[model samples]
Target: MNNPNALASQSFDLAAQQHPHLLRSASYNYPHRCAFKAVDDGDTQTVNQRLSISPLAIWLNLPARRFDTALGRDFLDSLIAEITLRKEAFGRRPVTQLLLRHPFLHYQGADITELMHLLASNFRLNHRDNSPIEYCAELLLEEAEGANLALLKGLGFNEFLLSLPASPSRGDYEKLHAIWQHAREFAADSLGVRLPYGYPEQDLHSMRALLDQILSLKPDRILLTPASELDRWNLQDHIHEHGSNSASQFALIYNALRHAGYRVLGNDCFVIGRDSLAIAQNQNRLRRTAIAYNSVNAADLLGLGPAASSQLGSRYESNLEAIQPYIENLQLHKLAIDKVLQLGTKAKACRVVADQLLCYHRLDIHYIENRYELALASLAENISWEFNAEANMELMRIHNGLLQLSDDGIMRLLFISDTFLAGLLKTPKKD
Candidate 1:
């Protein structure tokens, strides 16, 4: 059998060469011109000026353009197939049925007409059924409308358009609004109940109310997504500069949720309360925190629209941002996975340590040593002689401080005011 390791090394080099710009862009200190521009633009808009523009108003007038292209679609398909093969080979267990059923996992990009055609062809090829595909297409449409509404609200245009006078612009706003409203209504009627809005509200009271509702559901896991709220608010401001009332409401809501004991899990994802804390703390205490939950645990995260990411195990895949490339790729039966990273044990270990330290402000060295079979003394030995002595001697350092060694010979990182968990997690930059 062909060795995957040999293939991976070759693929890695090929990927690096093919996407030199992206590879180079991975450096942490890369300067961002757009950020500087945004900062510069922030001061120019007055509150009155902000009031005139709805965050989503510009997009309302802008064409409802498709973002993915044929090339991108084909690339994504091929990529998905490749990644799926790799996942089956190396992943710990069979991809769960729950994962396959998840909304995020089952997501295919929004161009319903295109997706329908593709589904129809697949049905024809298999000669099995078309009902599932038909149902999925309808579901996809509903999801698209929901996303559009989210974008509208997030961009601050939802309120702005609502506040607009009856005019051509208002008519345009109504057209887009009607499309999504109808979609939601259709879904409700078909599903036989009101679909729960997964998104949090924009007011503290409303947000708290939403949390109470979520808590009542007694979910096994909760994802905290402060960044999504922030992004929506920020994007709204960017759309017109002054920011919208809806975005302001969103920010207020997000803050309230955070105050109510939601801890961030990953980017734009959070889990609620003591349960999440307990899980994280236990993982930290056990030192298997890193291996337990991570990108690998992300069952199926399907990209719903353009420029979105989907995660299956440790493999993260993305779709093309442009409409043309996405279409062309799909026409060619390809999946647009522009980048792929098959994380190794070392990388996974680093991620775990980083996440624990960052979230809990502590580390269980005993847990790490026991789980990974690496000794703290050995780790200390690897440090330079001077730093090594400091680490070794610090075993008897002051009590109740930020850094401490437990009775079991595990290192405990307390609330060290000056230090951040990121420093410990990061790997040294490769020259």
Candidate 2:
């Protein structure tokens, strides 16, 4: 196979030349491979001796069908033993110091320790880090929540909310109030003392009262959760019965909050009319607030669990799924990898592009060009795509709201969907 580093080098070169400003200190070069020297027969093999070599190197040199065969599993197990002994040493080297030198290597090593153990055991890595035994469990939990939010933003819900914030114009509120009163009188007589199941007469009265209260509060933001039985029914069904009453309610509430100068945040999924509430900010205030929903997209995600998975670039591998196998393998100084998959480069590129688009919305054409050059130089270019100037225009049109072309003719990200953002990794996804 062609060298991955060479390809990466070529891409990096292109990106560096075009967007030197963006990649001030980014490494465009890949690490070089070195030959291993045989140890003297007279010398004893100690933990320090094992730490001298790269665990990745040991795993790569294994001949078990390259992560698919029994031999590969054994190789992985051995690698884990070496890593466990060296973990403390590894941690002793402050990450802050490393970041000062190589700011782009953002992941923490502790996150991948458990996966190292699991890989030594010849089991499939689950890639889920929710277990108590998992190292860096807290970090993984935060990553999971961020991932979920990214998914939500990707579904275009953010854009929907952006539009809904303007629905409650003062004129519209007055109209809604009149309509509500009229509906209340009609319902009072039509039911003749029996109210609707979900929409009882009292509920309408309550809704009206709530509206009044909201007007009085004049909050800068209002969050509402429909605690009534109407919430259980479909939105379409509610709209049919209420003749845009729900829509008006949303609009009125939103506009009321806006007039009151509060920012509103909520969704159709909200219950109890309001659960968690907060003040809203204007565009200028929001830009300064630095309030971002959880989102992360990184090239790899390494998880550590009895059975954890490590997603390297596009490839995914899992270790033994149970604690017993993992611990036993670790005791034996073995790797637990039980499953491995190689993904297509297109898929990998798509993930990368999706993440980039979601975060910044604009593709840096010059950056892509330089990256292509660097990939070529490094011989790590595993994927092929037409990333010329024209491609940038096409991508912009596809993800309209998320990206914008800068004055320099490079793509600049505009508004990334929370879904895509969540997928981006702020830390290493492993452990």
Candidate 3:
């Protein structure tokens, strides 16, 4: 199991089932598409996958959980240098961006404000001050203990996003207001925050309050559903006797955001007229792109530190969870990648189709069958299973090589993830 190659295989077969949410969220789909697992392992096959590929940029490391000025600067400089080298090696222009992952120490023993200050200094000193091309950075504020939206300016990241906690509450709505207020001040390019479920019919005010607050943020792009800790199926049966209560919840937020002038980009992500994503979608530029904001496209992420995950063109990999293994492997001049999944042609195509459905709730069956030689019949059948007796709905249809969901189903998108799995298995369960 320690063998990196074998671990990669196991990760695909084992971790994927257990960690379906990796694929559930439009943003987190990168790791799920690669191969998934929660273990200490590595992969060795297609070892040459790296040298043959071209990347937009090489990432710099994040500061430690607790900030150390010198180390963070060194990390930034090293990343910049690597970016230069990668650009040179590929014989491309000096147009490479740097990706910085949040160390996310939470409020346990660190202040995000200070971390922001440190990162801002590093960017000014290393990225913007010295570089000729407009060097940009994307901060995955996916995990942070507090919300000081002002801190983001110093970090110098063009794109900023977060995975809001799944437990939706009044305070959480207030937090969204603060985040949006700051996001507007800095024009925090696109924003994403999780919205948890379980709001009762009578407690509609809370849902309205939360959704309306998020609408007020007026973000250009929004990744709304980031995969809650609890799956819809796991909720009480009565809550979703009509299959799932997810659609109702999703509809609430969806309508509010739309009323506020936002339109759906794909499935779960939303964008207004001004955002670049909307521009691209208008120009017909959204073709096989990643769900991320500033990294090297979803497929080519370079996770530099422990707990970072990557999905390169042909390989899916992750770093060791412990710092020691990552450092030791680096010292030995070897890839610290402990988990890997060798992506084959069909899997890659399926990942794309899956992403399309997850994001847009539809797929080009014609394209898949014709291009990748994969069958949509199974996908179709799986979708059909969704509306079966268990879901308590007579909805869902597959026709003309396209997957379509009714207005009712759209509201239930949050809960359909399990249905997606059931459909994929070709056996829709009642539960």
* Maximum-lDDT candidate: 3
Q: Please say which candidate is ahead in lDDT: 1 or 2.
A: 1
Decreasing lDDT order of the candidates: 3, 1, 2
TM-score for all models, in order of appearance: 0.36, 0.27, 0.60
Candidate 2's C-alpha runs over 4 A off are 1-302, 311-315, 341-348, 365-431
Q: Write the per-residue lDDT of candidate 2 for residues 1-431, one digit (tens) a residue.
A: 34444433344444434333220111111110111122222122233333432111111111111123223333344445644643432322211100001101222334234433433343222223331111111111112233322332222112111001112446544543443343233221110000112232223345555556335422222224331321345533543465334334544444444444432221211111221122111121111000111111112333333444444333455667554576577776555666655444333333444434332334333343243322221121121122224234332222322234332222112112111222211111111
Q: In candidate 1, what are the lDDT values of residues 354-420, reduced to their tens digit?
A: 4444344344555654554433322222221222253464322222322333221112121111011
> How close to the true structure is residue 258 of candidate 3, measured as C-alpha lDDT?
64
Give candidate 1 misplaced runs (Cα > 4 Å).
Answer: 1-93, 97-222, 227-316, 342-346, 355-362, 366-421, 425-431
TM match of model 3 to true structure: 0.60
* 114: Cα error in model 2, Å: 15
lDDT for each candidate structure: 0.30, 0.29, 0.47
Worst 10 residues of 2 by lDDT: 95-104
For candidate 3, write residues 353-416 as lDDT tens digits: 5555555566676776666654545555544553444457754667776776654455444334
